[model samples]
Target: MATVEVDQDLCVGDQICASMEPEIYEMRDDGLAYVVDGMEEIDDDDLIAAAKDAADACPVDAIIVEE
Candidate 1:
């Protein structure tokens, strides 16, 4: 399984993660990116790929994926 996390302090609210993976990422009211509830840890291959893609797409590299 992979753990997905977003560093709110570093997030610039670009929404790239949310745009790439809406099911796992979202733009919160604070104007930062965050992993959706219940999606912090991912076991599915497709979801993992999506999460990784989102992490890579983050301009500020605020997204972290731990396997």
Candidate 2:
């Protein structure tokens, strides 16, 4: 399984991760991006790929995706 997380301390509210991978990431009211509820652990290959893409797209490198 692949796991994804956004480091709140490193998040810059850029929204790139959320935009690139809405299924795994979301922008909260605080303007920071977070991993959507129940989506931290991913089993689908497509979702895992998207998470990796989002991580690479994050300007602050706040998104962490691990297999």
Candidate 3:
């Protein structure tokens, strides 16, 4: 499984992660990116890949994925 996290301090609210993976990420009213509830740890390969992609797409590299 992969553990995913979004660092609010590093997030620039670009929403790239949210755009790339809406099921796992969202941009809140605070202008920061966050991982949706219950999606912190991912076991599905497809979702893991999507999360990795979202992490890579983050301009500020706020997203972290640990396998």
Off by over 4 Å in 3: none
Worst 10 residues of 3 by lDDT: 11-20
What is the Å distance of residue 52 in model 1 from its true position?
0.4
Query: How many angstroms is residue 11 displaced in model 1 relative to the true structure, after the best TM-score fit?
Result: 0.2
- Please give each candidate's TM-score: 0.96, 0.96, 0.96
- Candidate 2 residues 1-67, lDDT tens each? 9988899999999899888778789999999999999999999998999899999999888888999
Full-model lDDT, candidate 2? 0.92
Q: Which ten residues in a row have the lowest lDDT in candidate 1?
A: 52-61
Clash number by candidate, in order: 0, 0, 0
Cα displacement (Å) at residue 37, model 3: 0.3
Candidate 1 shows a clash count of: 0
Give the alpha carbon lDDT tens digit for every residue of 1-67 in model 1. 9999999999999888998899999998999888999999999999999999888888888999999
